[model samples]
Target: MTDAVSYPEPLAHPEKRGIELIESSERHGRARDLFPVWAAPNVSVLNFTVGATLILLGMELWQAFLVIIAGSLPWILTGIVATSGPAAGTSGSVITRAIYGIRGNRVVVAFFGWFISAVFLALNWLASSFMGAELLAQIGFTDPVLVPVLVTIIVAAITVLVAVFGHSLILRSYPVVASVLLAIFLLVTAFVLPHVQWGYTAPAPLEGLPLWSAMTIGFAILASSPLSYSNSPDLARYLPTSTKPSHIIAATALGGALPAIFFTSVGALLATGIDSAAMDLGIESALLALLPAWLGPIFVVGVIINTIALNGMTTYTASMAFQSIGVPIRRIPSAVVVGAIGTALTIYLVMSTSLLDAVNLMLQLLVLISGPTMTVFATDVILRRNRYSGDDLFDEQPGSRFWYSGGWHVPGLLAIGLGAAVASLFLTSSVWTGPIAAAMGFLDLSVPVSMVVTAGVYIALTRLAAKRRPTAIPSIEGAPA
Candidate 1:
C-alpha cells in the first residue's frame, strides 16, 4: 500500500559536491493520523527530559559544564527562535528547504541532520528502555535482563508504530507532553535544590587550566541537551498560530534553560557525596541515594521516562532525516529501523560499555558542523529573509539568497570551520581544556572566544572568497522533490 521513493540526485558538478545537493518528495505518506492536540504534552516531556538530562550529566562538574555551555551557547540559543516562532511550515523538511534554497544545495543540511538524528535515536532508546526496566525491577515484578530486553523490543516497536502512524499524533503531543515534563522537572528541582552547595568548587576544580578529564566530562555532559539545536523545527513546525512567535523564548528558556540549572544543581549536589563515580552513577541513582530505597524506585520510574520521551522524539526525527534524503520507508518501516538499531545499540552496546570515547569524538564532530549550520539558519530567519514567496518549498529554484547571489555560501562554511577549530583547541585534552587554553592565554567564557574566532575568520574568508568572482547560490534545481 506504499509507494517506493527514489530521490533525485543533485547536479553532477564537482565543485557543488561541497554541499550534498539532494531533494526528496513525500516518499513516506502520513505515518499517523493522530490529531495535533497532543503537541503541548509531547513538547512538555520532551523538553524536560532533554533539558534536565543534559544539564544533569554535563554540568555535574561545574567547569566542564561551563566549557560545554561556552561552546554550545550560540546554537542552543536558537531554541528560543525555534520554539517562539509562528507556524510557518507546512512540513518539517520545508523549513530546511527554505534555507537551503531552491537553487542552493540542501543535501548538506540533511546530512548533518541525519548524523544528529542517529546520535539522538541511539541515546534516547537506551535511556527510555532503562527507565521501563528499572521501574519494573523496582516493583520486583520482572526479571532483570529479560525485562530490560523485552521493554527495549517493545519500545522499538512503538517507535516504528508511531513513525508509521505519523502526522498530528507526534506533532500535537509536543506541547502537552512538554508541559508535563516541565511540571515534573520543577517539582524535582524544588526537592533537589536545597541540597546543592551553590558556588561550591566542583570536585577537583579545573586544575590550573581546566583538566582534560573534566573538560571531556563537560563535553559529554553538554551533549545531553542537543535536541534544541537539532530537532527544533520538527517541534517548531507544530507551533500554534495562537502563540505569538516571541513566546518561544519564554517557552524555551523555561522549558529548556531552567531545566539545565536544575539538573546541574542536582548533579553538583550529588557529586558532593558521590564524587568518585558521579559520571557512572547516573543522575537518577544519585537522587535515589538521597531518598529511601522505596522512594528511589518511585523517583527512578519518572527518570526512566528520559529514554521513552527522548527516544520517541529521536525516532521521529530520524524518520524525517531519512525522508529528507528521499528514503521513503513508510512510517512503520522507518520507525522499525531507527528503533531496532537504536535500542539494540542501547542494550548491547551501551549496557556493556561506557561510550565516553565515542561521545568525545561525536561531540567534537558535531560542534563544528552544527556551528555553521546554525549560523545559516538563525541568520536567515532572524536577520536576512522571511518566508519564501518565490518557489514552492519543495521545488528547487532560485527563491532566496542574500544579495541574490548564487552557488555555495562560502561565508557560512568559513564560519563553521573557524568555529570548530577554535572550539577544538579549548576542548579538554592532554594540552588543555578548550577554554583555559583560549583563556589562560586570553580568560572568559570559551564560547565568546570561539565565536570571535569563527566570526572573524569567516568574515575574512568570505571577503577573500568574494574577491575572485561573484558566485550565485548554487542551483539545487532538483532540491525540492
Candidate 2:
C-alpha cells in the first residue's frame, strides 16, 4: 500500500524532537510583564525556625556573637536577595537562554536541575512540615502531629495554585507578605532585647568546643541560613534580560538579610535567658511568647504564609525538574504530584526520625547541588572559549556540549555525585577512624565541602573531557533547530 516507506525528517532524531518541544516551552506568556518575575522576592522563614537547631547548637558548641553574626548575616542577606526564580511567561526562556548557549542546550541544564530538584523536594517537605507542626503544638494546638499534617496539606495546595497562575502573581504577592514578616521580626526582636544578658554572656565563647566537634554540631545544623536560600531564582526567569541582573541580585539580598538578622537575634536572646527559657519554649514557642495575646492569630498566619512562600518554590522547582526530564505530566499536574510526594514524606519524618537531622540533611544537599549548577552555568556562559550567545535560542544541534553522548554528561554527573558522596563519608561518618586530622570533623560538609569538591571536580573533569572530544558538534540540520 505504501509506495515507499519514509519517516518525516523530525521523526528520525528523537533528540531533535526533544529539543523542539523544550524550545516551545521557552515561549510561554510572551506578552506578560517582566517586573513581576524579576521583583517577586522570596522571604524564607527558616531564619526563625532554624533557631530550634541553632539554639541547640549554641548550648552545645559555641554561641559566639561574632561568629553567628558572620556566618548567619551574609547567608541571610545573600540567600534571599542574591537568589531569584527561573523565568516564566514571555521572557522566561530569555534568562535561561542567556545562561546556556543560544544554541539551546537547556536539556543539559534540565538534567542537572532534575537531580538537584529531586533532593530539594524531599528537604522542603520535611523541613516545612516538621517545623509547621511543631510550631502549632507550641501554640497549644491539640495533637501537634495531626496539626502539622493538615497545615502541610493546606500549604501545598496554596503553592500549587500560585504556581499554576504563574510567576507574575507570585512576584506581586511576595512583597506584601514580606512586609508583614518584617514587622513581625522587628517587633519580636525588640521585645526580647531587654533580656539579652550582656553582663552575663557578653563575651560569648568564640571557642567553646573542640574544633572538630564544633564543625560537626555547629555548621552542620547552621546551614539552613534562610537568607541565602529562600528566594531561589526559579521564579525570576520572568524578568526581562534588559532588567539589570545586578539590580535583581541586590533587591533579593536586602530582603533576605532582614530575616537573618531577626532570627539570629531571637536565637541569641533565647540563649541569653537560658535560665528562664524552658526546653519546650525552645525557639518557635519563645517567639510566640514574645508576641502580645492579640497577635497569636497573626503569628500563626505568618507561619502559614512563610510555608506557602517557600513551598511554592519547592513545588515549582520540582515540576520544572520533572518537565525537563520529559515526564508526560504537564506543569500543573506535576506540581500536584510533587507537592503530595513532599507532604507524604514529611509525615513519615514527623512520625519516625529526629526532625533536626532531616533539617540538616536537606540544607546540606541544597548547598551542594546549588554550587555545581551555578558553577556550570557561569563557566558555560562566561568561561567557554567558544561562545554561543544571542537569540540562538532555537538552536539545538545534536552532539552539542549539551547533547553530547546521548544527552548524558558524565563529567558533570560524576562531579556532583562524587562531591556529595565524599562529603558524606569524610564529614559525617560516625565511626571516626583518624584525623588528618580535624579537617571538617565528623559532621556534615554538604555546603562547604561540596562547594569545594563540586568546583574542583567540574572544572577538572570538563578540562580533561574537552581535550579528546571536539568542543562543538557538526552544524547539521538533521537534529534540533
Top model number, lDDT? 2
Candidate 1 wrongly placed segments (more than 4 Å): 1-76, 80-93, 97-106, 130-148, 160-167, 171-176, 179-208, 211-228, 238-244, 275-284, 328-332, 355-365, 390-392, 397-418, 429-481
CA error at residue 434 for candidate 2, angstroms: 9.8
lDDT per residue (tens digit) for residues 106-183 in model 1: 456456665666665655555555555656766685675677677767766765554554434444444455555556
TM-score against truth, every candidate:
0.66, 0.71
Q: Please report, in order, the local distance difference test score of every candidate based on alpha carbons.
A: 0.46, 0.47
Q: Which candidate's TM-score is highest?
A: 2
Report how far residue 250 has shifted in candidate 1, in Å.
Answer: 3.5
Query: Which run of 10 residues does model 2 get worst, by summed lDDT?
Result: 11-20
